[model samples]
Target: MSHSVASPSPKLSSWTHTIGASLEPWINLTRVSRFAGTMLVFWPYAWSLTMTARSANLPVARFFYLLFCGFIGASLSHSAGCVWNDILDRDFDRQVERTKGRPIAAGKISVPSAVAFLWAHLGIMLWMVRDVNSLAFKIALVTMFPLAGLYPLMKRITYWPQAWLGISMNAGVLMAWAFITGSIPASAFVLMGGTWAWTIWYDTIYACQDKKDDVKAGVKSTALLFGNSIKLVLALFASLMMSALVVVGRLNGHDLPYFLLSVVGGSIYLAVQLYAVDTDSPKSCWAAFHRNGFNLGALIWAGFLADYIWAAQGPALVDFARGVAVGW
Candidate 1:
């Protein structure tokens, strides 16, 4: 009886199937680790914008605008970079355990689709930075073009690709300060330097995860090059970051307590990372990599408190609650 009117179920069109496959790649591209890394990079810009706004005595709305523009540009730029990296490193990615499941490496995504996504994100980033400041837009352009083209080559040639990547990440400090103030201040160099060291140091830790696979794949990274001496390198890099923070705080005329607070906070955070990390254990190394978020948070909080203290010309904690409430 059932065979009398048998009919086939409707099949999805080619376009529908294409779109379904495309979505998974985009979703995978926006991994949690990627999101966290992006957020950490953008946080300095947000913090700097708030400081500039407070220094000018502007309302929270103006500060929010700077933050909005910076976030949009940075996020779009990061999206493009991620897609491009996946495309370029697809073959190498398949050799690494953590990266093996990525959409591009898994063959779930087409290279043409990834390229289209990259171009779209780049266009959006360009538009966003244009609205912020010409100087920032220029910086974004400089950072994007060279970094995007050359970053993939790092794995092929240099063990310190993370250091080169640091330059790209910390360029945000200059972009943010110039966008808000319309000029590069002395503070910009100090902050940028600190950000650079911090990024390189943390990224080195992250690279540890891929060290074994990377070596097997004939790729280079600091994790392999530094070998057993990574801890020493990380400690030195972290020290440089803290030193930069101290110098910047002083130049901005922050109280001694402000400088001390940041140094101590950063040091404690770094100690937790350096002391507890077991480079031989991939699990421990991954944990250490994730802990950088806390380190960054400490630095941000210290900077915010210091800036508020300078503005109030009083104890750092005096206006802590009020400063936080007003987005300072």
Candidate 2:
């Protein structure tokens, strides 16, 4: 008699499934662990807010206050966006392996429930931004509906849904500037363009994971549009993204840290990711997309933060640096 070796994978998977199924349907519907995507929404807001704070010499207390508000706002909006996307794609999601188990697709949550949840996020977001400048409030409203709301539909009719996402995701760049400054600047629009290009860069990689499924499901994406030349097109977008950021730095008069970390380091990291990702492999594509949200985002935000702090307390930082250089 021989004892067959039972691999641990199935047991581990069963345990994971059990834990997953135990969660409340609403939480699962939100994909609460998609923090990466949520943070992507927050970063543009933070970066632009800091830039405006530095330029306007706004009080540090207020800056932090706005930053906190921005974080809360981003989380809510991203959740709402996810709910909206899921609602519109529930049928298509059922046909895709990666999305088939999603709450709506799996019959764990009804479309009505999902829509109600989406409304909940939107209502909270509206309340949070109630005191914002009217212009900023309108922009925020636009982002929630005509922009993010239209994103899922874009995939049905166009190959450039990523382009729409780029616009929607980075619209916060303008909203932050408007909220704090009461006006948008040419430089902020330039920054929006850069982040827009970046959204396409990362999302096309993300889309690559579902290329085959998307084709059969009649979905459109940049990954399928670029086809054999996907990498080439992505590289072009990468170049456009970096170039726009550099231009915005020039326009905004950002500190050397912005140039070094956000521009130089950012470009290097992007090149590495683009080179290392095997778009043909779903795992590789997902890894690259995740890294963009985590690592790449950090680089850009660090530089913006450094510039903002230096502007806010330049003389103090210089004095502190001098003391450290002389060993106190």
Candidate 3:
């Protein structure tokens, strides 16, 4: 009886390997190590929520809840967009030294498997935003098609794929505004414009990493389009972004501190990045791109958070001061 033990079935082993292989590529394709990109995508949404909550006196708990939702939505949507991009650009990725190791390009995943993964991500994203306000939900629906569906094709048709990306990526500013205010505003568009300019600036830097391969592969991008004038283009976009920031701050009645930290500080950081970036060096381009996540993104959010805290607490502090004065 003890000698009657049986070996594992070959069919079971084959099925196990198939399941693991199917899921493994998803982790690589999502580029989870590049967490910076996800946070950068999430920041505009968080900023809108914080600013709107401050101005509207919305409950702090509600603001946090919505911000968390934006984080999850942004991450899922960004991952889906990446998978779609990889699927569309598999051939192009194989030609680029930097992207040649990508899951789809390396043939670690089949296109059908990738498509399935993409739909799964989109399905979860939809579920996450389902409880949001109607305006936000509608905007999310409309924008998802363009960002996740059309963005991968833009690179084939236009040198301004970065511009398309700008429009798509920053649409979150509007969605977040609608989520909180139940309607979008003129100011939200202004902020969106600023966010668009910022996208062009940083994405151009990101594109620089693949400029040589992109050109060889006939892939058009702002990095290739701008060429020797790339720095000038970055400067112009950075200025536009800063101007938009100033306008949005004024529209929202943000205090001097907000302008100083978000607008001024962010400008200085961008300037340093521009100065330090070597457009010809892929390493420099990658560094500059990642820097945008923390330097500009965190600075802007810090200003908004500080402003919100002060606005919520300032009256109490003033009242205490007045009471002390009267007692004295």
Answer with 2 or 3, whichever has the higher lDDT.
2
State how far residue 158 of model 1 sits from its true place (Å).
1.3
lDDT (10s digit) by residue, model 1, range 1-328: 3557655544656667778776766778756345666666676666566556546665556666767777776677667777888999999999999899888889878899888878888787776666666787788788888965688788798878877888787677777677767887887788778878888788788888888898889888888888888899889999998888777776666655555566676778787878988887888877776667555555755655556545654545567767898995
Q: TM-score per candidate, in order?
A: 0.83, 0.91, 0.90
Lowest lDDT sum, 10 consecutive residues, model 3, at 1-10
- Give the local distance difference test score of model 2: 0.90
Clashing pairs in model 2, backbone N/Cα/C closer than 3 A? none
TM-score of 1: 0.83
lDDT, ranked from best to worst: 2, 3, 1
Candidate number that wins on lDDT, 1 or 3:
3
Candidate 2: worst-modelled 10 consecutive residues by lDDT: 23-32
User: In order, what lDDT does every prediction score?
Assistant: 0.74, 0.90, 0.87
Scored against the true structure, residue 165 in model 3 reaches a CA lDDT of 89
Position 46, candidate 2: lDDT: 84
Supply candidate 2's per-residue lDDT for 271: 92
Tens-place lDDT per residue, model 2, 1-328, is 9999877798899999988777767786776687888888888888888888888988889989999999898888888888888898999999999999888889988888788888889899988889988889999899988999989999999999999999999988999999988899999999999899999999999999999999999999999999999999999999999999899899999989899999999999999998999999999998898898888988898998888888888999889999999995
lDDT by residue for model 3 over 1-328, one digit each (tens)?
3667688899999999999887776777997778878877888887888888888898888888888888888888789889989999999999999999999899888899889988999899888778888898888988889665898899999999989988888888988778877987777899989999999999999999998789899999999999999999999999999999899998999886688888889899889988999999999898888888766798988888888887888789889999999999
